[model samples]
Target chain A: MIKTSTQNELIQYVYNELADDACTQLEAAFMHDNELAEGCSELLQIQNLLDTALKSPHQRAVQNILNYSKSLSLQS
Target chain B: MNTTTQVSDSALVSLYIAGNENAFEQLVNRHKNKVYTTILLIVKDTYTAEDLMQDAFIKAIHTMKSGRYNEEGKFSSWICRIAHNLAIDFFRKEKRSPMITLEDGSNVFNTMAFAEDSAEQFQVKEDTHARLRELIQTLPQSQREVLMMRHYADMSFQEIADSTGVSINTALGRMRYALINLRKKMLNSNIAYDKNLYSE
Candidate 1:
């Protein structure tokens, strides 16, 4: 049972775009509250998994563009 | 790797402005992949992505040729800004549906075979991806555009704001809401919220 205020602060903390004092407050809150710690942990995991899964496979496309560049150079 | 060949992007732009066409090719070669991939994720189709990539490069070249490019900023960011605007224009004019329906052969995950996992888990992950995509599509167009630029294109909040002509706070707020909405949607799906599930 994380407090609503603390949970919101923790979500903002994960973005790492918050000010230093806010980050310190989030760290202290996590240390004191089990539910907050667990929720933050779960959200971080979800973020990491989603980031990996959503990465587009564009290596082949990049290679194709490079090949096209070479052919254009040859023609010129 | 030829050290001299790796000229700074600004230098290449200057070269292109001096009527050196090869410099324009260098610029395209450097940014083609990033532009193509960013557009592909936004449009969610290859053909449109290809056309948009070409359009982005052509527009960049035209800008340089016309002497409108200022060397005061990052060339990559400027070109990406152009691509972002073009993608948004396409979205507005097309009014296309955002939902990517997972028909029989359309599942991107079908090619990967997970080892030792139950069919159930695989199905859950796939469903979650599809649901996330649909949810992203449903986002307010502004929020969706910001999310795509921030996450997929790896633009900073400032860059997103500048490119989309919105405030920095608005860009950050849109991303915050986008993630919150996505998390809510995931919670409602069959994929149970388990910290350990992702660690494996």
Candidate 2:
């Protein structure tokens, strides 16, 4: 069974935020543990869900920024 | 004018400081989407987010003009921090809850209807965003902030810690809880992480 600390490490591993040595250790652990591997898959899916959920800002926001920047350049 | 791809953020910063207006445009264009998305996630309103984004760019320009712009960090991260702070400041000033809650207190997800429209693809995209936002709103403030910074602002855990005045481990722990909490919420809520549902 994967411990809470291992689950935490798995979170970092899925995000690719772990350092090299820790990442290697996690991968090795996953190889030996089916449960850990399944947990990793679930976390990865969550990450992908987050990525899909993000919305692009409206074009009006982009235009507003451009106009503001132009005004600033003119004043300088 | 050099192509935007050819210039690094630092180089663009230098050019803008050296009075090249176009360079500043390139820099803003390069990172505007990320900055806007980052702010929008926190503020959760389109008009207010747009205003805050403009304010953020103006603030960045003011800092650069006043010789206060630190060149040590990535320009994108610098602007993102400004956007994030502006959103936080708004919440504080208005004394508004950052929570995206509805009237019934059952969470926004339960009220949403994922109806298929003529533009089926766009409908799916909107539904996915709605579902995700619901899940995010369910998270505690700290976890939500860390998740947004990491995913939307593209900040490292160390960067998030620095911005939030926490230790790296604390930031990492927040992220871990955020993911775990989100996973639980998704499962319990029956929110499928189907790629086909999101992809057009």
Candidate 3:
């Protein structure tokens, strides 16, 4: 099992900010620390899900803004 | 030469200031979706969010035309700050909180533990999308706004703080609480789904 210090290190690894070596260390830590592994895995999943779900709404809202702004420009 | 790729925000602002309306259009094209989505998350309604987004961009253009925009600030960030302020104004006028408070009164950490993890198995299925939208609707206005700024619009905590007049730590704290609350809602709703669904 990954030691406690290593498990803490894995927890501190921000998915977008981690270097390759740090990410690999996180992978190794996850292999040994089941609880930390599960938590990290779940959090990453949640992020992905949220990202996907928000994409369409984001696009639609932007389009609405663009159309509105264009109309305003024409009127002014 | 990929000229568009090389043009900086300051360059675009300069062009717009020089009376090139298309430059402003290009800037809006580049950042509108981000701005709109950020507003949508705060307002939680389609029509009002769209109106606020337009107003934000119009206000930015006015600022530029009036020679009030600072060259030091990034154009997108400046526009975002405008949008943020407009959203706050909206909430203030309505005399309502910005986020949907959780009815269960559970702590964020505990709620996260119970959230569903089915996004892994289904890969953005329609039901999953619906569930996510429903869960977001459950968040308080402040939490929803912070989450949208952080995740959808991809603004940093400092940017959110600058835009919302909140401290950086407060923005981060709201996002932290948002995630926890979202997780809790998902867990409560998805307990009947398969257990190993998220396991690779």
Candidate 4:
């Protein structure tokens, strides 16, 4: 099993939050470690899937917001 | 020619503050999906999410226009933080259970349907989004909060730590578990319906 610290680093690495040196080290480890690499792969897949769940608001609502700002601008 | 991708959110905010309306439009289009989803997860209603999103942006409009805007942090994070807070305050005042039945997410598919003609593919995508949001609602409150803040709000772990009142390590740990749990949930939800039931 990979260490908890390594797993945490993997999360940071996927999120692009790990420090540069640690990121370099993790990249090197990925070439040699199958389990660590698989963990990273799963994290990435889930991240993408989570991102796809994003929904857009109706266009009318957005139009209202823009119009409100425009109206305020006109008044100002 | 356009520099949409090349322009930073900060630059756009600066332009908008300088009274460039197009820049504000770009800013809204760029981050609208994230802002909407962040609140949708909290309020669990598209109509309410839309209303709250408008309120959030109006609040932002006033802040940016009134010279109170802070340029210290990423604009996406700042705006989403506002959206997130408004969503939570909504929950507090309403005291509603967030697990209400979701109208299929495709209900809002019309928002972007004007740009794309692939109705079949678009419907599938919206259905997936709806299912995922429903599953997110099933997560424990802490995990759901961390996941939404990090993924939807685009907040760094340090930012999440400060905002959620937890140590950075604890914040990271919660996010780690949240992702792991979400993966497991996705897998289970995918196979819950056996093929035998539909066999000819």
Candidate 5:
């Protein structure tokens, strides 16, 4: 089972925020740990959902921001 | 001017300051969806999120023009900070949860009709997407905010800490819980992890 600290480490690992040695250790652990691998898979799935489902915003919002930008003076 | 892909965000900001509004356009076109997605995750309303995004860009322009953008160089993160703060301000002013709202003020979840076992695979995919959206809405506010800021704003834990007024450890802790919570929720819902979900 993934401990609390490992859960935190998993977050860092998924985001590539972990340091070199810690990442290496985690990778090695994943090879021997079914629970760790499952946790990592679950985290990756959440990330995938977020990326694919939340990819775009409303088109009107895009136009509105562009229009608002056009009205501004950029001279500094 | 070089292609937007060839130029850096800092260079784009400099060009905008040099009176090329299209430089600002390039910046917006490059980062708009990200900014919008970040704001929408927090505000949970399309129109309000757009308004906050507009406010964010306006504030960004004003700050850059007035020569107060003192972030050293990370222009994208700087704008994200503005949007992040605006979203917090919106929630504080409204004093409500960020409930997902459909355009007609109806519940999107209530309309979901899961496909039968015999249905096409595409229909199941659509159902899963809708279910995941609903599940995201159920995440705790603290965890959800941290997850969104990290995911959408592309902020480091340190940057997220500075923006959200939390310790870096706290930010990281919240992200940990966010992932754990999402995993638990998905498992409870019987949503299997499909490798192709991300690869496709």
Candidate 6:
């Protein structure tokens, strides 16, 4: 099993927040450990899936925001 | 070609403050989906989400125009933090519980342009995405909160820890479990985790 610290670092690594030396160490560990590599793979897959799950607001709503911003600027 | 497309959020914020309307437009278009998604996940309704999104942006505009916009952090993270807070405040005031209230994906998924996806491909994408959103709502409140803050709001784990009153390690732990639980639930729900489906 991966140590809790390693798992926490794994989270940071996936999110691109890990420190440089720690990230290098994690990559080195990934090569030697099948479970660690698999865990990384799974986390990445979820991250991508979450990106796809973002939903957009309606077009009119966007237009309203833009128009309001412009109107406010015009008045000032 | 529009060169502002390559401008960073901080640069865009500066341009907007200098009264370049296009800069403000670019900023809104750039972060709108993430901002909208951040709010929608909390309130569980598209109409309310859209309104709250406007309120959030208006608040940002006021701050920027008043010369109070903070330049220390990423503009994406700062704007989304605002969106997240407004959504949470609305949730508290309404005293309504979050439910999987998305009856149709069309309302939430708007006309933002995408690559020329085939009709069949679009349907598959929509179904998988809608299902994933439902699964997100099923996450425990703490896990969901951290996930949205870190994942959707673009806040760093350290920021999440600071805002949520937890240690950075605890924030990271919640995020890890959030991802793990999301994967498990996606598999259980038969949602697509396939990279190929989204790569097109």
Best by DockQ: 6
Local accuracy of candidate 4 as per-residue lDDT tens digits, B1-200? 78555788899999988898888898999888899989988887778999999999999999999999999999989999999999999999998876646565345433433235367756555555567777887888888998999899999999999998999888888989998888788778772222221111
Q: How do the residues B25-59 of candidate 1 rate in per-residue lDDT, one tens digit apiece?
A: 67776776556656755676666776777677667
Interface RMSD of each: 5.6, 4.2, 7.8, 6.3, 3.9, 1.7
lDDT of 5 by residue, B124-196 (tens): 6656665666676688888887887787777777887887799877898998888778878888999877765
Clashes of 6: 0
Instruction: State the lDDT of candidate 6 residue by residue for A1-76, as single tens digits.
Output: 9999999999999999999999999999999999999999989888887888888788798888888889888989
TM-score of chain A of each: 0.67, 0.89, 0.51, 0.95, 0.79, 0.97
Q: Give the Å error, residue B105, model 1.
A: 5.9
Per-residue lDDT value at A70 in model 5 = 67
Interface RMSD of 1: 5.6
- Model 3 TM-score is 0.61
Q: Score each candidate by Cα lDDT.
A: 0.65, 0.77, 0.64, 0.83, 0.75, 0.87
Q: Residue by residue across A20-63, what tens digits does model 3's lDDT show?
A: 78888777867877877876766666676675554222445545
Best by lDDT: 6
DockQ of predicted candidate 4: 0.57
List runs of model 4 lying over 4 Å from the truth: B1-5, B99-121, B191-200
Estimate, for each residue in B50-149, the C-alpha lDDT of model 3 and write its tens digit: 7788788778866777788888756766677677779879978988764564324222111122135454445434445545666887788788877776
Supply the global lDDT for candidate 5: 0.75
DockQ of each: 0.20, 0.46, 0.20, 0.57, 0.47, 0.72
Candidate 2 accuracy as lDDT: 0.77
